[model samples]
Every structure is written in C-alpha cells, then in structure tokens.
Target: MKILLLGQHGQVSRELQLLLSQGHELIVLGREQLDLAETDNLRDAVRRLQPQLIINAAAHTAVDAAESEPEAAFAINATAPGVLAEEAAALDVPLIHYSTDYVFDGSKPTAYHEDDLPNPLGIYGRSKLAGEQAISAVGGKHLILRTSWVYSLHGRNFLLTMQRLLQEREQLSVVADQIGAPTWAGSIAAATVQLIERWQSAQTATWGVYHFTARGETAWFGFAEAIAAQLQAQGKTVAQLTPIATTQYPTPARRPLNSRLDCSRLERDWGVRLPDWHDGLLECLNASR
Candidate 1:
C-alpha cells in the first residue's frame, strides 16, 4: 500500500509513521513540505505522489488561538480538507481524515453520537465542523474519525503538560467541569490501521463520520489526578491535583463541557475500541519513562 500521510510531527502522525513503516510505502509530509493553509500545495503533493490512500492527520489544533485567528484556522482546517477530499475524489482513492469532538456543544447529558447534530461553541469547533461538512460535500470514499482529548508521549498534549507540572510543582489546579475521554494517540493510530485494512478488504464498507476514543470518560482534574497517581506509583513525587470549574480557568475559546463520544457504533461496525483512559494513560506513562 502506498500511503500519503500529512502532519509528520504530530502525535498521531508520529504513531502512524511508525506503525505504517513496515509492509507499506509511506510518504510523510510536514508543514515545510506541505503547508495545509495552501490548498494548491496539498493538491499538488497528492497529484505528484499519486498515493493509493490519503490519511490526513494535520489540523489547526490551537484551540484558544483559533479564536483570534479564525481565518488561518479555517484555511487549514476547513479549506484544506475540502481540497483534499476533492483531490481524493478526482483520483478515485480513499481518504481517512481526523476530526474533533468539539463539533458538539456538550449540552447533551449523554455521550455524543455520530448522528447528533453539530452545534459548535467556538471558532475552533466551528472551523473543524466546516471541514467535516466540506469533506462530506465532496462525496468521496472517506472516513472522518472524530476523537477527543488526544494525548501522547511525544507531543504537546495534556498528558505531557501534566507530567511536566507534576515534576515542577507541588500542586496544580485543573478544570473539572470539562469532561471527555483522554485518548492516547497510539490507540488512535492502531485503530486507524484496522479501519484501513477492513476498508480495503470489505466489499461493502460504510464510509462517513465515526467517534473514536478511549472507553471511559473523566474531567480534566480527574485525568490530572490519574497522572499524579501513576507518577507516584513510579516512585516519583507528584503534585496535588486541585479541581476547578471552567469559570475559574477561562480561555479565549469556549470548550465543550461534555466531550464524551459514544463509540459503540464504531466497535459494532469495525470491532475496534480503545482501552480505558486510565489504561491508555498507564501505557503512555510507561513508554515515556
């Protein structure tokens, strides 16, 4: 399989590069090689590579920063995805893209399902939702896998931040109002391979949006507490995690309180589901150590 993967240095992209290195021809591109903000460049790269599959892991992931840079975010997250979808459709190849749980407003008491109507709360969420719509509008063989609270061992994510803070500070406060599954990037990468394999073999495979994340949910504070506990278990002095409300820690962009996504549909259809948040966290922590 010839795979053209975007976002070479991203957490999930890094995992994808490692996982797809064997038994496949992988062409990974970073911002310098392919600036997603420039749709022409993205299209040109795809045209030049002529890959059998396109996996877009790139995104404008600056959540709060997107509030002030909506245009830039839209350019990369929205316009670029539409262009990729169009190019993939023209090439008659499959595209696997990643989205976020921010598409929902988090007002629902229960976990979000794929069928739930999107009601983005901030510029970042709105831009991501726009990208999703743009990709779907192109009518290609695509899979828009939406995940939440992504963290990893080798990235600027919540898990790494907490690890640094626990090492430096005696105590820390984290927002408890916000809730979601802390998905490991490696888990996402592994599941993505499964989807790609199934999609290649299955004569009739459903292609659309699907929520992929860890099996459980927790607030930011709870997640921090888990990190601290793990560090302590590893014989390291950790910080005291203090729970705080969203109001106490406001950001430029509003975040969805309930980012819990229902993954039963994905599991039922593909027989793929990530481990529990704590379990994934342990694996990440162990790998980092």
Candidate 2:
C-alpha cells in the first residue's frame, strides 16, 4: 500500500513511520516539505502524490502556546483537515486523522464517549473539535481517532519532562486535580496499523469518531510518582514529589480536569485494546533504556 503520512517527527508519527514502512510504500512530508498551514500547498501535495491512504499525523500541538495564536492553530488543526478530507473523498480513499480528548470540558464524572457532545474549554480544544466537524462534514471514509495524554521517547511530552525534573529538581509539585491515561505513541501507532489492515481487507469498521487510550488512568502527581519510583529503582536520586491542586498552577490554556476517554466502542468495533497507563509507561521507558 502507498501511504502518505503528513508528519515526519512527532512521537506518534515517528512510531507510525517505523510500523507502516515495513511491507508498504510509505511517503512522509514534514513541515518544510508540505506545511498544513499552507492549505494550497497541502491540497496540491496530496493530489500530486495520489497515495492509497492519507494519514494526518501532523497537528498544532502546543496547548498553552495556542492560546495566543488562534489563527495559526486553526490553520493547521482546523482548515488543513477539511482540505485533506475533500481531497481524500475525491480520490475515493480513506483518510486517517487524530483528534484529542481536550474537546470535552472535562466536567463529566466518568469517561467521555464518542457520542458525547463536545464543549471545548480553550482555543486548542475548540480548534481540534472544529477539525473533527470539518472531516465529518466532508463525508469521507475517515477515522477520527481521538486520544489523550500521548507520550513517547521522542518529542516534547509529559514523560520526558518528568524524567528530566526527577533528576534536576529537589522537590517537584505536580497537578493532582487533572487526570488521564498516559498513552504511549508506540501503542497508538500499532493500533492504527490494525485499523488500516482491517480496512484494506474490507473488514469494514464503523467510520467516524472513536476514543482510544491506555486502559487505566491517573493524576499528574501519580504519574510523576511513577517516574520517581522508576528512577529510585535505577539507584538515581529522584525529586521529592509534591501533589498540588490545579489552582496552584496556572497556564495560558485551561486543561480538562478529567481527560479519561472510554474505549469500549473502539474495542467492540475494531478489537484493539491498549495497555494500562503504568504498563505503557514501562514499555516506553524500557524501549528508551
């Protein structure tokens, strides 16, 4: 299969590249080659490449930074997706795209489901939600897979930050109020290939939105503690972890207090299951070591 991936260096993209390259013709375009911000160039690139499958692994992922740059965020996260959907629909090919759990307000006591109404709390969430709407409106064969708290050995993510802080800071204060599963990028990549293989074989999954993530969940403070425990196991001096409330920390954007997403629908339809947050973290760290 000829696969055109829209991101070259993101955590999930990096994993996807490795997984998709085996036994497939994979074409990847980074920002320098095909910027999503440049809508015209993006359309032209997709049409010219004429790939069998289009996977948009690129996104404006700067959550706090996006608060001051709504236009730029929307350009990549909103406008670019709609254009991809249109082009994919024209070619009669399936488009695989990623979304986020931030689309919810995080007020729900339980996990958020695909059928739940979206009420984004900030520009980042709002833009991502808009992108999902655009793709659905275009009426294309697309998989809008929404995930949460993604991390990997590559890229800027929470796990890397915690690893660094556990070594540097004598005491670390992590937000205990906000909670979600720490999903690994490699796991997401593996699940994506399952979707592609099934679709290619005409197994036919219900097309639309789905929430997929690590099975279990935890607060940021708990995640930090997990990192600390691992460091201690390595005979390394770790930080004195302190749990803090959301009010104790402020950011440019408001984060969802509860980012838990239900994956029963995804598993029921696609038969894909993710590891627990702790297991995923261990796998990621083990791979790094």
Model 1: lDDT equals 0.91
RMSD of 1: 1.1
Error of 2 at 260 (Å): 0.6
lDDT at position 75, candidate 2? 95
lDDT for each residue of candidate 2 in 1-289, tens digit (9 for 90 to 100):
8999998999999999989888999999998888798888988998899999999999999999999999999999999999999999999999999999999999999999999999999999999999999999998799999999999998899889999988998998999999899899998998999999888887875889999899998999998899889989999998899999999999989999999999998888988788888998899889876
The residue ranges of model 2 lying beyond 4 angstroms of the native Cα positions read: none
Error of 1 at 126 (Å): 0.7
RMSD of each: 1.1, 0.8
Cα misplacement distance, residue 179 of candidate 1 (Å): 1.1
Q: How many clashes does each candidate structure show, in the order listed?
A: 0, 0
Candidate 1 per-residue C-alpha lDDT over 14-103 given as tens digits, one digit per residue, 9 for 90 to 100: 999989999999999999887898877788899999999999999999999999999999998899999999999999999999999999
- Candidate 2 has which clashing residue pairs, if any? none
